[model samples]
Target: MTQFIVSLAVFLALHSIPAIPAIRQRFIRVLGRRPYLVLYSLASLAALAWVFHAAFQLDYVELWPPSAWQAWFPLTLSPVAFFLLISGLFSANPVSVTFRRGDMKPGAVVSITRHPVLWGFLLWAAGHIVANGDLRSLMLFGCFALFALFGMVMAERRNWSNPLNASTSIIPFAAIAQGRARFGIDPAMILALALTVALSAWLLLGGHAALFGTDPLAMTST
Candidate 1:
Protein backbone atom coordinates (compact mmCIF):
# COMPACT_ATOMS: atom_id res chain seq x y z
CA MET A 1 0.00 0.00 0.00
CA THR A 2 3.02 2.29 0.16
CA GLN A 3 2.78 2.95 -3.55
CA PHE A 4 -0.93 3.54 -3.31
CA ILE A 5 -0.59 6.07 -0.54
CA VAL A 6 2.27 7.83 -2.23
CA SER A 7 0.43 8.08 -5.53
CA LEU A 8 -2.77 9.23 -3.85
CA ALA A 9 -0.90 11.85 -1.85
CA VAL A 10 0.79 13.26 -4.90
CA PHE A 11 -2.43 13.30 -6.86
CA LEU A 12 -4.39 14.95 -4.09
CA ALA A 13 -1.70 17.52 -3.38
CA LEU A 14 -1.51 18.58 -7.01
CA HIS A 15 -5.27 18.68 -7.34
CA SER A 16 -5.86 20.45 -4.04
CA ILE A 17 -3.84 23.49 -4.96
CA PRO A 18 -6.43 26.20 -4.50
CA ALA A 19 -7.11 28.43 -7.51
CA ILE A 20 -5.44 31.53 -6.14
CA PRO A 21 -5.46 34.28 -8.73
CA ALA A 22 -1.99 35.52 -7.84
CA ILE A 23 -0.47 32.04 -7.90
CA ARG A 24 -2.12 31.24 -11.22
CA GLN A 25 -1.03 34.61 -12.60
CA ARG A 26 2.58 34.03 -11.61
CA PHE A 27 2.63 30.57 -13.16
CA ILE A 28 1.19 31.87 -16.40
CA ARG A 29 3.62 34.78 -16.47
CA VAL A 30 6.60 32.50 -15.94
CA LEU A 31 5.65 29.60 -18.20
CA GLY A 32 3.37 31.31 -20.69
CA ARG A 33 -0.21 30.10 -20.86
CA ARG A 34 -0.12 27.07 -23.17
CA PRO A 35 3.04 25.56 -21.71
CA TYR A 36 1.78 25.93 -18.17
CA LEU A 37 -1.51 24.30 -19.11
CA VAL A 38 0.18 21.43 -20.95
CA LEU A 39 2.58 20.76 -18.06
CA TYR A 40 -0.17 20.77 -15.42
CA SER A 41 -2.43 18.58 -17.51
CA LEU A 42 0.33 16.04 -18.07
CA ALA A 43 1.24 16.02 -14.37
CA SER A 44 -2.38 15.44 -13.37
CA LEU A 45 -2.72 12.56 -15.85
CA ALA A 46 0.48 10.96 -14.58
CA ALA A 47 -0.68 11.24 -10.99
CA LEU A 48 -3.97 9.51 -11.84
CA ALA A 49 -2.17 6.70 -13.66
CA TRP A 50 0.12 6.21 -10.69
CA VAL A 51 -2.83 5.93 -8.30
CA PHE A 52 -4.44 3.15 -10.33
CA HIS A 53 -1.14 1.36 -10.82
CA ALA A 54 -0.44 1.42 -7.09
CA ALA A 55 -3.93 0.23 -6.17
CA PHE A 56 -3.93 -2.76 -8.49
CA GLN A 57 -0.36 -3.79 -7.62
CA LEU A 58 -1.22 -4.32 -3.96
CA ASP A 59 -0.87 -7.86 -2.54
CA TYR A 60 -4.17 -9.64 -2.14
CA VAL A 61 -5.54 -8.81 1.26
CA GLU A 62 -9.24 -9.22 1.84
CA LEU A 63 -9.96 -5.85 3.33
CA TRP A 64 -13.33 -6.17 1.75
CA PRO A 65 -14.45 -8.72 -0.77
CA PRO A 66 -16.83 -7.93 -3.53
CA SER A 67 -20.35 -8.05 -2.18
CA ALA A 68 -23.86 -7.90 -3.63
CA TRP A 69 -23.81 -4.27 -2.48
CA GLN A 70 -21.32 -3.58 -5.24
CA ALA A 71 -24.10 -4.13 -7.74
CA TRP A 72 -24.86 -0.49 -7.07
CA PHE A 73 -21.45 0.51 -8.35
CA PRO A 74 -22.16 0.46 -12.07
CA LEU A 75 -25.72 1.59 -11.62
CA THR A 76 -24.69 4.74 -9.78
CA LEU A 77 -21.51 5.32 -11.71
CA SER A 78 -22.84 5.14 -15.26
CA PRO A 79 -24.63 8.46 -15.41
CA VAL A 80 -21.89 10.40 -13.68
CA ALA A 81 -19.26 8.88 -15.92
CA PHE A 82 -21.36 9.66 -18.94
CA PHE A 83 -21.74 13.23 -17.78
CA LEU A 84 -18.02 13.68 -17.40
CA LEU A 85 -17.26 12.01 -20.68
CA ILE A 86 -19.87 13.92 -22.63
CA SER A 87 -19.04 17.21 -20.96
CA GLY A 88 -15.40 16.77 -21.81
CA LEU A 89 -16.11 16.11 -25.46
CA PHE A 90 -18.71 18.75 -26.29
CA SER A 91 -17.51 22.22 -27.25
CA ALA A 92 -20.87 23.74 -26.41
CA ASN A 93 -20.51 23.55 -22.65
CA PRO A 94 -19.32 26.87 -21.28
CA VAL A 95 -16.92 25.17 -18.91
CA SER A 96 -15.11 23.04 -21.51
CA VAL A 97 -15.11 25.70 -24.19
CA THR A 98 -13.50 28.42 -22.08
CA PHE A 99 -9.92 27.57 -23.00
CA ARG A 100 -10.61 27.65 -26.74
CA ARG A 101 -12.37 30.99 -26.61
CA GLY A 102 -9.23 32.73 -25.32
CA ASP A 103 -10.59 33.29 -21.87
CA MET A 104 -8.88 32.07 -18.70
CA LYS A 105 -11.68 33.58 -16.69
CA PRO A 106 -12.31 31.38 -13.63
CA GLY A 107 -15.79 32.55 -12.86
CA ALA A 108 -17.30 31.30 -16.11
CA VAL A 109 -17.72 27.87 -14.59
CA VAL A 110 -18.19 29.19 -11.08
CA SER A 111 -21.41 30.92 -12.01
CA ILE A 112 -23.00 27.52 -12.47
CA THR A 113 -20.99 25.90 -9.66
CA ARG A 114 -17.44 26.75 -8.72
CA HIS A 115 -16.03 23.50 -10.03
CA PRO A 116 -17.77 21.02 -12.29
CA VAL A 117 -14.66 18.86 -12.48
CA LEU A 118 -14.54 18.59 -8.69
CA TRP A 119 -18.18 17.55 -8.78
CA GLY A 120 -17.21 14.78 -11.22
CA PHE A 121 -14.34 13.77 -8.92
CA LEU A 122 -16.71 13.53 -5.96
CA LEU A 123 -19.02 11.27 -7.92
CA TRP A 124 -16.17 9.01 -9.03
CA ALA A 125 -14.61 8.83 -5.54
CA ALA A 126 -17.94 8.07 -3.85
CA GLY A 127 -18.79 5.36 -6.34
CA HIS A 128 -15.42 3.67 -5.83
CA ILE A 129 -15.70 3.84 -2.02
CA VAL A 130 -19.12 2.20 -2.14
CA ALA A 131 -17.79 -0.54 -4.40
CA ASN A 132 -14.59 -1.21 -2.43
CA GLY A 133 -14.85 -1.64 1.31
CA ASP A 134 -11.16 -2.10 2.16
CA LEU A 135 -9.80 0.27 4.78
CA ARG A 136 -7.08 1.63 2.53
CA SER A 137 -9.40 2.02 -0.43
CA LEU A 138 -12.09 3.51 1.72
CA MET A 139 -9.76 6.02 3.33
CA LEU A 140 -8.28 7.05 0.01
CA PHE A 141 -11.51 7.46 -1.92
CA GLY A 142 -13.39 8.86 1.08
CA CYS A 143 -10.89 11.61 1.75
CA PHE A 144 -10.87 12.66 -1.89
CA ALA A 145 -14.67 12.50 -2.01
CA LEU A 146 -14.96 14.78 0.97
CA PHE A 147 -12.30 17.08 -0.40
CA ALA A 148 -14.13 17.45 -3.72
CA LEU A 149 -17.46 18.09 -2.03
CA PHE A 150 -15.98 20.71 0.28
CA GLY A 151 -14.05 22.29 -2.57
CA MET A 152 -17.21 22.85 -4.60
CA VAL A 153 -19.09 24.40 -1.68
CA MET A 154 -16.15 26.52 -0.60
CA ALA A 155 -15.38 27.68 -4.12
CA GLU A 156 -18.98 28.60 -4.75
CA ARG A 157 -19.00 30.98 -1.83
CA ARG A 158 -15.47 32.33 -2.27
CA ASN A 159 -15.39 33.11 -5.99
CA TRP A 160 -16.83 36.24 -7.49
CA SER A 161 -19.87 35.78 -9.72
CA ASN A 162 -19.61 36.88 -13.34
CA PRO A 163 -22.38 38.13 -15.57
CA LEU A 164 -23.52 35.50 -18.03
CA ASN A 165 -23.23 36.13 -21.74
CA ALA A 166 -26.52 34.61 -22.82
CA SER A 167 -25.09 33.84 -26.21
CA THR A 168 -22.35 31.68 -24.74
CA SER A 169 -23.75 30.49 -21.43
CA ILE A 170 -24.88 26.90 -21.26
CA ILE A 171 -28.28 25.82 -20.09
CA PRO A 172 -28.44 23.07 -17.52
CA PHE A 173 -28.87 19.50 -18.79
CA ALA A 174 -32.43 19.41 -17.59
CA ALA A 175 -33.15 22.67 -19.37
CA ILE A 176 -31.65 21.30 -22.55
CA ALA A 177 -33.74 18.17 -22.26
CA GLN A 178 -36.83 20.24 -21.84
CA GLY A 179 -35.97 22.31 -24.88
CA ARG A 180 -34.50 19.51 -26.93
CA ALA A 181 -35.95 20.84 -30.13
CA ARG A 182 -33.42 23.67 -30.23
CA PHE A 183 -30.44 21.34 -30.09
CA GLY A 184 -28.75 19.91 -33.15
CA ILE A 185 -26.66 16.78 -33.23
CA ASP A 186 -23.65 17.23 -35.46
CA PRO A 187 -21.88 14.35 -37.20
CA ALA A 188 -18.65 14.91 -35.31
CA MET A 189 -20.44 15.00 -31.96
CA ILE A 190 -22.21 11.77 -32.83
CA LEU A 191 -18.94 10.08 -33.78
CA ALA A 192 -17.23 11.28 -30.62
CA LEU A 193 -20.02 9.99 -28.39
CA ALA A 194 -20.02 6.65 -30.18
CA LEU A 195 -16.27 6.33 -29.70
CA THR A 196 -16.42 7.27 -26.02
CA VAL A 197 -19.15 4.74 -25.31
CA ALA A 198 -17.27 2.04 -27.16
CA LEU A 199 -14.10 2.82 -25.22
CA SER A 200 -15.89 2.80 -21.90
CA ALA A 201 -17.47 -0.54 -22.69
CA TRP A 202 -14.13 -1.99 -23.72
CA LEU A 203 -12.58 -0.91 -20.44
CA LEU A 204 -15.48 -2.34 -18.46
CA LEU A 205 -15.16 -5.74 -20.08
CA GLY A 206 -11.71 -6.61 -18.67
CA GLY A 207 -9.88 -5.22 -21.69
CA HIS A 208 -7.51 -3.09 -19.62
CA ALA A 209 -4.46 -4.78 -21.15
CA ALA A 210 -5.18 -2.76 -24.26
CA LEU A 211 -5.08 0.52 -22.35
CA PHE A 212 -3.74 0.33 -18.78
CA GLY A 213 -1.48 -2.76 -19.06
CA THR A 214 -3.73 -5.14 -17.05
CA ASP A 215 -7.30 -6.05 -16.47
CA PRO A 216 -8.68 -4.24 -13.41
CA LEU A 217 -11.29 -6.88 -12.60
CA ALA A 218 -8.59 -9.54 -12.47
CA MET A 219 -7.22 -7.77 -9.40
CA THR A 220 -10.49 -8.14 -7.48
CA SER A 221 -12.80 -11.08 -7.15
CA THR A 222 -14.43 -9.29 -4.27
Candidate 2:
Protein backbone atom coordinates (compact mmCIF):
# COMPACT_ATOMS: atom_id res chain seq x y z
CA MET A 1 0.00 0.00 0.00
CA THR A 2 2.79 2.40 0.85
CA GLN A 3 4.64 1.64 -2.35
CA PHE A 4 1.45 2.00 -4.37
CA ILE A 5 0.65 5.36 -2.78
CA VAL A 6 4.17 6.64 -3.28
CA SER A 7 4.26 5.63 -6.96
CA LEU A 8 0.82 7.12 -7.56
CA ALA A 9 1.87 10.42 -5.96
CA VAL A 10 4.96 10.56 -8.17
CA PHE A 11 2.92 9.81 -11.28
CA LEU A 12 0.47 12.60 -10.49
CA ALA A 13 3.28 15.03 -9.73
CA LEU A 14 4.92 14.35 -13.08
CA HIS A 15 1.61 14.81 -14.91
CA SER A 16 0.44 17.83 -12.89
CA ILE A 17 3.18 20.07 -14.27
CA PRO A 18 1.57 23.50 -14.72
CA ALA A 19 -0.10 24.20 -18.05
CA ILE A 20 1.25 27.68 -18.72
CA PRO A 21 1.31 28.48 -22.44
CA ALA A 22 4.61 30.32 -22.19
CA ILE A 23 6.30 27.44 -20.41
CA ARG A 24 4.87 24.84 -22.81
CA GLN A 25 5.72 27.02 -25.81
CA ARG A 26 9.27 27.34 -24.58
CA PHE A 27 9.52 23.58 -24.14
CA ILE A 28 8.19 23.05 -27.66
CA ARG A 29 10.71 25.53 -29.01
CA VAL A 30 13.60 24.00 -27.09
CA LEU A 31 12.73 20.30 -27.44
CA GLY A 32 10.81 20.37 -30.74
CA ARG A 33 7.25 19.00 -30.88
CA ARG A 34 8.09 15.46 -31.96
CA PRO A 35 10.83 15.11 -29.37
CA TYR A 36 8.66 16.58 -26.65
CA LEU A 37 5.76 14.28 -27.53
CA VAL A 38 8.05 11.29 -27.49
CA LEU A 39 9.53 12.38 -24.17
CA TYR A 40 6.07 12.82 -22.68
CA SER A 41 4.97 9.40 -23.90
CA LEU A 42 8.06 7.75 -22.45
CA ALA A 43 7.60 9.50 -19.15
CA SER A 44 3.92 8.49 -18.98
CA LEU A 45 4.74 4.86 -19.80
CA ALA A 46 7.44 4.80 -17.13
CA ALA A 47 5.11 6.17 -14.53
CA LEU A 48 2.43 3.64 -15.43
CA ALA A 49 4.91 0.80 -15.24
CA TRP A 50 6.08 1.97 -11.84
CA VAL A 51 2.48 2.17 -10.62
CA PHE A 52 1.71 -1.33 -11.83
CA HIS A 53 4.85 -2.71 -10.22
CA ALA A 54 4.13 -1.04 -6.91
CA ALA A 55 0.48 -2.10 -6.98
CA PHE A 56 1.18 -5.80 -7.51
CA GLN A 57 3.80 -5.70 -4.76
CA LEU A 58 1.05 -4.95 -2.26
CA ASP A 59 -1.31 -7.66 -1.05
CA TYR A 60 -4.55 -7.85 -2.99
CA VAL A 61 -6.69 -6.13 -0.37
CA GLU A 62 -10.30 -6.95 -1.14
CA LEU A 63 -12.59 -4.04 -0.29
CA TRP A 64 -15.64 -6.19 -0.86
CA PRO A 65 -16.51 -8.94 -3.28
CA PRO A 66 -18.10 -7.55 -6.42
CA SER A 67 -21.85 -7.64 -6.23
CA ALA A 68 -24.14 -9.34 -8.74
CA TRP A 69 -24.83 -5.87 -10.08
CA GLN A 70 -21.18 -5.65 -11.04
CA ALA A 71 -22.06 -7.70 -14.11
CA TRP A 72 -22.96 -4.36 -15.63
CA PHE A 73 -19.29 -3.55 -16.02
CA PRO A 74 -18.71 -5.11 -19.42
CA LEU A 75 -22.12 -4.07 -20.70
CA THR A 76 -21.37 -0.43 -19.93
CA LEU A 77 -17.73 -0.52 -21.01
CA SER A 78 -18.24 -2.35 -24.30
CA PRO A 79 -19.78 0.58 -26.13
CA VAL A 80 -17.35 3.15 -24.76
CA ALA A 81 -14.38 0.94 -25.56
CA PHE A 82 -15.77 0.16 -28.99
CA PHE A 83 -16.08 3.83 -29.89
CA LEU A 84 -12.72 4.83 -28.46
CA LEU A 85 -10.75 1.87 -29.77
CA ILE A 86 -12.49 2.06 -33.14
CA SER A 87 -12.10 5.83 -33.44
CA GLY A 88 -8.45 5.47 -32.55
CA LEU A 89 -8.06 2.60 -35.00
CA PHE A 90 -10.03 4.20 -37.85
CA SER A 91 -10.03 7.77 -39.21
CA ALA A 92 -13.61 8.41 -40.30
CA ASN A 93 -14.97 10.89 -37.76
CA PRO A 94 -13.68 14.44 -38.11
CA VAL A 95 -13.15 14.33 -34.35
CA SER A 96 -10.72 11.45 -34.79
CA VAL A 97 -9.08 13.01 -37.84
CA THR A 98 -8.69 16.46 -36.31
CA PHE A 99 -5.96 15.11 -34.08
CA ARG A 100 -4.23 13.46 -37.03
CA ARG A 101 -4.72 16.44 -39.37
CA GLY A 102 -3.33 19.16 -37.10
CA ASP A 103 -6.47 21.12 -37.95
CA MET A 104 -8.08 21.12 -34.47
CA LYS A 105 -11.41 22.15 -36.00
CA PRO A 106 -13.35 21.48 -32.76
CA GLY A 107 -16.12 19.94 -34.86
CA ALA A 108 -19.10 17.94 -33.60
CA VAL A 109 -16.95 15.94 -31.18
CA VAL A 110 -14.68 18.70 -29.99
CA SER A 111 -17.54 21.20 -29.90
CA ILE A 112 -19.05 19.25 -27.03
CA THR A 113 -15.75 18.25 -25.38
CA ARG A 114 -12.03 18.45 -26.05
CA HIS A 115 -10.64 15.17 -24.76
CA PRO A 116 -12.18 12.03 -26.22
CA VAL A 117 -9.25 9.80 -25.31
CA LEU A 118 -9.34 10.95 -21.73
CA TRP A 119 -13.08 10.42 -21.65
CA GLY A 120 -12.68 6.88 -22.91
CA PHE A 121 -9.92 6.25 -20.39
CA LEU A 122 -12.22 7.52 -17.66
CA LEU A 123 -14.94 5.09 -18.67
CA TRP A 124 -12.52 2.21 -18.82
CA ALA A 125 -11.05 3.08 -15.43
CA ALA A 126 -14.44 3.48 -13.78
CA GLY A 127 -15.71 0.21 -15.18
CA HIS A 128 -12.70 -1.68 -13.87
CA ILE A 129 -12.83 -0.11 -10.43
CA VAL A 130 -16.54 -0.76 -10.04
CA ALA A 131 -16.22 -4.38 -11.07
CA ASN A 132 -13.27 -5.07 -8.80
CA GLY A 133 -13.73 -3.57 -5.34
CA ASP A 134 -10.27 -4.41 -4.05
CA LEU A 135 -7.73 -2.00 -2.62
CA ARG A 136 -4.94 -2.96 -5.05
CA SER A 137 -7.31 -2.92 -7.97
CA LEU A 138 -8.83 0.40 -6.96
CA MET A 139 -5.48 2.05 -6.41
CA LEU A 140 -4.15 0.83 -9.71
CA PHE A 141 -7.18 1.72 -11.83
CA GLY A 142 -8.46 4.69 -9.83
CA CYS A 143 -5.15 6.48 -10.12
CA PHE A 144 -5.36 6.12 -13.90
CA ALA A 145 -8.91 7.46 -13.96
CA LEU A 146 -7.87 10.46 -11.91
CA PHE A 147 -4.80 10.95 -14.06
CA ALA A 148 -6.83 10.81 -17.27
CA LEU A 149 -9.30 13.37 -15.94
CA PHE A 150 -6.55 15.75 -14.79
CA GLY A 151 -4.48 15.19 -17.93
CA MET A 152 -7.45 16.17 -20.08
CA VAL A 153 -7.95 19.42 -18.19
CA MET A 154 -4.26 20.35 -18.29
CA ALA A 155 -3.89 19.34 -21.94
CA GLU A 156 -6.97 21.26 -23.05
CA ARG A 157 -5.82 24.35 -21.16
CA ARG A 158 -2.61 24.25 -23.17
CA ASN A 159 -4.33 23.53 -26.51
CA TRP A 160 -7.02 26.19 -25.98
CA SER A 161 -4.85 28.66 -27.88
CA ASN A 162 -6.14 29.94 -31.27
CA PRO A 163 -9.48 28.13 -31.35
CA LEU A 164 -11.33 28.57 -34.65
CA ASN A 165 -14.26 30.94 -34.44
CA ALA A 166 -17.62 29.24 -34.88
CA SER A 167 -19.07 31.79 -37.29
CA THR A 168 -16.21 31.68 -39.78
CA SER A 169 -15.11 28.08 -39.46
CA ILE A 170 -17.64 25.65 -37.98
CA ILE A 171 -21.12 27.16 -38.42
CA PRO A 172 -20.82 27.86 -42.14
CA PHE A 173 -19.97 24.30 -42.97
CA ALA A 174 -22.57 22.93 -40.56
CA ALA A 175 -25.24 25.23 -42.02
CA ILE A 176 -24.30 24.47 -45.60
CA ALA A 177 -24.55 20.69 -45.40
CA GLN A 178 -26.15 18.37 -42.89
CA GLY A 179 -23.74 15.64 -43.96
CA ARG A 180 -20.79 17.89 -43.18
CA ALA A 181 -21.71 17.94 -39.52
CA ARG A 182 -22.08 14.21 -39.49
CA PHE A 183 -19.30 11.93 -38.41
CA GLY A 184 -18.24 10.95 -41.91
CA ILE A 185 -17.25 7.48 -43.06
CA ASP A 186 -13.97 6.58 -44.72
CA PRO A 187 -12.03 3.50 -45.90
CA ALA A 188 -9.54 3.85 -43.05
CA MET A 189 -12.41 3.87 -40.61
CA ILE A 190 -13.92 0.79 -42.22
CA LEU A 191 -10.55 -0.92 -42.06
CA ALA A 192 -10.20 0.07 -38.41
CA LEU A 193 -13.62 -1.31 -37.55
CA ALA A 194 -12.94 -4.56 -39.37
CA LEU A 195 -9.59 -4.91 -37.64
CA THR A 196 -11.07 -4.14 -34.25
CA VAL A 197 -13.66 -6.85 -34.75
CA ALA A 198 -11.05 -9.37 -35.69
CA LEU A 199 -8.72 -8.34 -32.88
CA SER A 200 -11.53 -8.54 -30.34
CA ALA A 201 -12.43 -12.03 -31.49
CA TRP A 202 -8.83 -13.13 -31.31
CA LEU A 203 -8.38 -11.64 -27.88
CA LEU A 204 -11.38 -13.52 -26.62
CA LEU A 205 -10.18 -16.80 -28.07
CA GLY A 206 -6.50 -17.56 -27.52
CA GLY A 207 -4.99 -14.16 -26.67
CA HIS A 208 -6.48 -13.21 -23.32
CA ALA A 209 -4.59 -15.50 -20.98
CA ALA A 210 -1.39 -15.23 -23.01
CA LEU A 211 -1.37 -11.46 -22.73
CA PHE A 212 -2.98 -10.61 -19.39
CA GLY A 213 -2.36 -13.86 -17.51
CA THR A 214 -6.12 -14.26 -17.01
CA ASP A 215 -9.25 -14.62 -19.05
CA PRO A 216 -11.50 -11.56 -18.82
CA LEU A 217 -14.78 -13.39 -19.09
CA ALA A 218 -13.67 -15.95 -16.53
CA MET A 219 -13.34 -13.28 -13.87
CA THR A 220 -17.08 -12.77 -13.51
CA SER A 221 -18.52 -10.75 -10.59
CA THR A 222 -20.37 -12.57 -7.82
Candidate 2 segments whose C-alpha is farther than 4 A from its true place:
16-23, 67-104, 150-208
lDDT of 2 by residue, 100-145 (tens): 3333233333332334445556777888788778987887888778
Clashing pairs in 1: 66-222
What's model 2's lDDT at 122? 70
Q: Scored by Cα lDDT, where does model 1 land? A: 0.55
Instruction: TM-score each candidate.
Output: 0.63, 0.63
Q: Write the per-residue lDDT of candidate 1 for residues 141-200, one digit (tens) a residue.
A: 787788776655554455335333232223234323444323344443455457657766
CA lDDT of each prediction against the hidden true structure: 0.55, 0.57
Which parts of model 1 are misplaced by more than 4 Å?
A: 1-3, 56-65, 75-79, 85-114, 160-195, 209-222
